[model samples]
Target: MDYDIAIVGGGPIGLAFARSLAGFGLKLAIIERQPLAALARPDYDGREIALSQRSVRILDDLGVRHLLPPGGVASLAAAHVLNGGAKRALVLDPARRRRELGKMVSNQDLRRALFEGVAGQDGLDWLVERDVEGIAFEPASAALSLNDGRTLRTPLVVAADGRLSQTRQAFGLGAEMNALGRSMLVVKVAHEHDHGQIATEWFDHGQTLALLPLQPRQSSFVLTLGDREIRELCALPPAALAAELERRSKRRWGSITLLSEPFRYPLVTTFAHRFVAPRAALIGDAAVGMHPVTAHGFNLGIQGQATLARQLAESARRGSDLGDLRPLRRYEQRHRLLCRPVFEATNHIVSLYTDERPHARALRGALLGLGARTRLPRTMIGTMLA
Candidate 1:
């Protein structure tokens, strides 16, 4: 098989890339190791992605925004950060930043929406349950060998396969993986409080807990803790775990109960040393995997996909080689510039709040107080949503 671009990984990032290039007169194929039905399932477990205004705008442009299930996307009008056990809260109104601060949607729903959008468009092909065994790149085209003894060729190959990208390894791309000695326990809970479209985060000395408002009478709870602590919590029965969460959160929502099984993910920062190699380019987590503390991982992926599509489209308009090193370099440059600062900031914030030193605690409290008083910092955060 031949195509203008071969995208490895049928996740939201790959699907978004396909949708972005729908009308560009380019043939694109997405290869995935999982069946389409598996991705479309409503019960798939993953963190809910908080889409920024910029991300929503890009999705709207691709005409997939409405495909999100009814009530699947929750508008967050306000965000509150609490310190010292919710004794002090700093509230920031995201609505003041833009028409809508952002929207929270299940990862499965978002992926299904993108897949449907791409599947309905022309010049897009889906290859599921197919794994790439190896990649051989040349100036004219790149050849990808599948485990099933089939070979696919394309002028450009996008390595959106994820942080552990096999394509990246085939091309000898090096990356730095910083493993934070922490994991996140995420679960949905039924609550009596209205929550009023408010997203709340509570930062204690060693852990940070977040309650993200979902549709009527529900919210997603994300608890970050050390590995040992997580294991202990996981060993507890469901009711016990709910009790612990309620105590940790200081019963802010009156009382809490688990609505689903708890899911845990190790916290890590994956930094791909390069974003492009010869006839291939990287997008999404394949390029940069961020800490979840800032909720920038998926949003960054969307932005990277959009930036790559726009750069390639411009190259095509000028009759330039789409896989040319120059065009790919431009994409890498812009994406790195946009992602690096957020990655660093998130890491720094995590370290500051999770430290155990008394001095660090005092510093964290002072910083939070200062952030509350400063209009400039608040404005900058507001602009980030925009």
Candidate 2:
């Protein structure tokens, strides 16, 4: 085998997984199709990842947190969910007073941090601008054929590609994928009124909106609408769109001005039938792609990759087979337990809020009221958030 383990992705999750095994004396290779220059300097893609407290701790331990760009991270002090047109909201505040609920970091900054952490490792080989033409798994190892006519063998392989993972498809693993017709349009906008560092989730009849606080008067707006409605909204001129946002928001922010180009992301949720195949395993979005309504997608990815990495590292220390199904099964078990409930809850929330039926609305309103009165669930959320 050319390497003990080969990671088929150079994204943050994959890089973090590689970094997690840094102290272990194991041969590793990271296969990435992205150009090295791009990896070294990733572009700002308007994605502000709301990382849970646990995730922040993981990144800090991996030494990637300090590499993040200064002033690029924000604090989420509290979150409130509003159902339909109800004046009241299900409030979720931080566990402690005057402290943050979680940290919000940009995707580009995270990628830069991950690249810095993984680029200079001694026991790892960086395979750049390479495509996997084919993959075959065996009892002993997995053979990955690259587009450059190179066949690399590894005792273990991990697919950290993405939600629509090519490696997973090649491995013939099935996934439960839901392509929701709604499209989420995200953009940063400056407002006249201050947001007080509070995150707000508003579930309207035909749209679901979230306003994540940034600075005093700036926030990232995520508005979900039907596919056609989203295309029309995206097509609107900046001025028209700004007015539309302001009108839709009911001038709660006083007035809104577009700060960046709107980014439209189609809402799709996916979960792999299994997280492992023979000598291979899946991590991050490859294993479970989540709906963003719960704001646990990226956090779960970090946690999932961490779980797999921990198991692999322990196996390495014990001189056991890295390809053994025992540790892989353990990883899958732990990660699935973490993601399954959240996935189901997110789906339920989307359904309840998106449903326009009278009974559904009343039920959603009642649930929101119950959530507001409940302390245990909010406390659990606070515990989950960093």
Candidate 3:
């Protein structure tokens, strides 16, 4: 197969790229190992994603916003940050800024929306159940070899295969993984209380827990803890684990019951040494695996894909080779410049809040208090959501 762009990985990020490039007069093909039916299934329990206002704007521009399922999206109106025992609370109101803090939607819904949006778009092709075996870059084109002995040749290749991207490694642009020695236990639960579009995060000494409101009576809980603690939590019976979560959350939403089996994902920081190499470029987690505490991983991926699409479109319009080093460099520069600071700041925030030392705890409490009362810090946070 020959194409102008061949996108590896058909996850949300890759789908977003295809959607963004829908109207553009560029031939695009998305290759994925999973079939369309499998991708549409909601078997995975880790279904929630926090979508920032900026992310919403990007989806809106692609004409895929309305594809979101009914009652599957929740607007984040307020966020409350508590220190350990709930003695200190920092509340942020998105209404003050005249913009939603973010939106919460099921990961399945997001994938389905993006997939449907790209279905009939011109110059787009989705090749499912095609496992990539290798990628080779030539002087004029890049070729992807599939496990089935098929080859896809394109002028530009996008690696959105995720943190452990085979495409990235195949291109000799593997990332440096910095394990934070932590894992997140994620699950959905039925809350008795009306959370009313409120998202809450509690920072204890060893764990940072978030209760993100979903639809009418659902919420997703993410508990970040050390690997040992995660193992212990997972080993416990579902009832026991639910009890522990209720105790830790102070039963804020009344009695908590596990609605799904718990899952753990190792928390790590990964950065590709280079986002671009010859005829190839990396997007989303293939480029940067962000810490999930800031809830920016998927958001960053969406933005990264959007930026790449814009850059590629402009390059095509200017009669420049989309796969040229110069065009790829521009995409890399823009994404790195936008992602680096957020990455560093989120890492710092994790370190500070997870520290059990007396001084660190005191400082963290003070900072949280200041953030709640001061306009500057609040505005900075508002900008993140915006």
| Weakest lDDT window of 10 consecutive positions for candidate 1 | 91-100
Judge candidate 1 against the unseen true structure and give its global Cα lDDT, from 0 to 1: 0.84
TM-score of each: 0.95, 0.97, 0.94
Ranking of predictions according to TM-score: 2, 1, 3
- Find the candidate with the highest lDDT and give its number: 2
The residue pairs in collision within model 2 are 53-386
Worst ten in a row by lDDT for model 2: 377-386
Candidate 3 residue 242 Cα shift, in angstroms, is: 1.9
Q: Per-residue alpha-carbon lDDT of model 3 for 1-386, expressed as tens digits?
A: 38989999988999899888876688998888888787665356585898988899998998999999867888887788888774757877664747568889988888888878888889887788898888878899888888889888888989999998988998899688898888999998887787888888888766788989987668898998889999889889989998999887778788888888888888878889999999899999999999887789999999999888988889878877878888789889999998999988988988899899999998988898888777765677677776
Name the better of 2 and 3 by lDDT.
2
lDDT per model, in order? 0.84, 0.88, 0.85
Kindly indicate the candidate among 1 and 2 with the higher TM-score: 2
**Measured by C-alpha RMSD in angstroms, how accurate is candidate 2?**
1.4
